[model samples]
Target: MPVISPNTNYIRPSPYRSAAPPRSPGPTPEEPLPQPPPVVLDDSKESTHEPCWALDAIRYSTIVGAFSLTSADLKLLKKVPRGDYEDDDHHDRRITRTQSQILSRHGQRIDFGFGSSGRLKHRGMPMYALANAPEQELYRNMSSGGTAVMKPFSLRQIRVRFLWPLPRGEEPSHEAYDEWVRVDPLYTRVQLAMAVARVFYRFVEANRLYLSQYHDYPWRLRPDVFYRVWLLGLERVDTNVFVADLKYVKDYPNE
Candidate 1:
């Protein structure tokens, strides 16, 4: 090789040299990178602003036991003829006397009346007392001296789905949806327990005709029986669907 001149420019690649491009400067003041929106964790504000789908159903149930009275009870009661005071006065008097006797036996002072529609109505009791009277009276009437001990119905594990009615042309945000997904199961469990208790009491009222025929045994809903009501569920299926897993135990003392 000819002698290289001292002034000759030569280039050589080094194995350790990186081939990557130079990094650009960080975000400038004029055109900064987009920062994520701030996350809010105010539960009270969130709850206050939360949609009413869940609350609406709960309020409806509390004000009226379930949505409507049991159809079985309604059908049975409707079969009775409407009262014509001149014709049915004796029958109404007999019914009122029987009701007074029953209330006296149970130590309850509330009076019962036949309305113009011929429906049985409580004259001097609160709405809740009337709603709960049947079951309570059944137990009182059955027990000897009202001192008999009966085992309460046992509730097993309850599994429920988180569902809420979506308003027309409205949708839940990701945060709200996630919150509901987290809390709905718990809320449903509590409401279901309350509903089950309410239904247990109402069962006596709804099935009074059938129960009255059984005089040998205690006239109450069988402790081991499984009673279900669609309205007792937290929300209507059209709005929210739920499943209540119930298991009854045979623990009532045999007479």
Candidate 2:
């Protein structure tokens, strides 16, 4: 055995140092990997973000009913990020990004941490966390309603789980505070997607037309034109003239 000196430097081999020669390539092309069909989960695998079909019918009916009761033309409200805690009493506390990422919702938040640490790490317990329960309008973790609307259900918990909570302490607009818990962005977006699917299923079930008859038709040709606009499932959006004509409704009271 050679005695190695403590001060001697050792040279590391190059990463690709194998001395073997490359083999000749085969002429045939490789087969492409197959893609999987999309999955739609049922209630057994439901998450807090989703409402069941029966529940959705009841809830959506209530909301639509409430809108109908307004004698004057109701200007539909615009959705904005509401996951902020300072604006509402839902979030238990003001939370760090890591903590809020756990529950993955856009609503009046609890500022509760979601991950394994299961704590309100930096900001301490949110004021809402100490509250016995949230206000009636504020939704808790439940997807029981969508079931009634006959909506398409996809597994979104995985995506939602890692999503960060809304930024705390947004600018106070009197208009913003009044509707704090009315229309949550994430839930509305998801609900809209379901509404679109429901129309398609209705068309098929009613035998108004075969899917092949309108397979290539634009989604515009579908039933209940308004529901198509539900649950955009995205944030920080702008609508240009090319997108959709802006109809100015009398400015909403909150605005």
Q: How many clashes in each structure?
A: 0, 29
lDDT of each: 0.24, 0.23
lDDT of 2: 0.23
lDDT of 1 by residue, 110-224 (tens): 1122122222232111122222334334232221212311111111221122211112222320000000111122222222233334433333233334323334432122321
Model 1 weakest 10-residue run by lDDT: 173-182
Roughly what TM-score does model 1 have, to 2 decimal places? 0.18
Which lDDT value does model 1 have at 129?
24
Top candidate when judged by TM-score against the true structure? 1
Model 2, residue 93: displacement in angstroms?
Answer: 17
TM-score of 2: 0.16
Clashing pairs in 1: none
For candidate 2, lDDT tens digit of each residue in 45-93?
5455533433322222232222222324222322222233344433333
lDDT of 1: 0.24
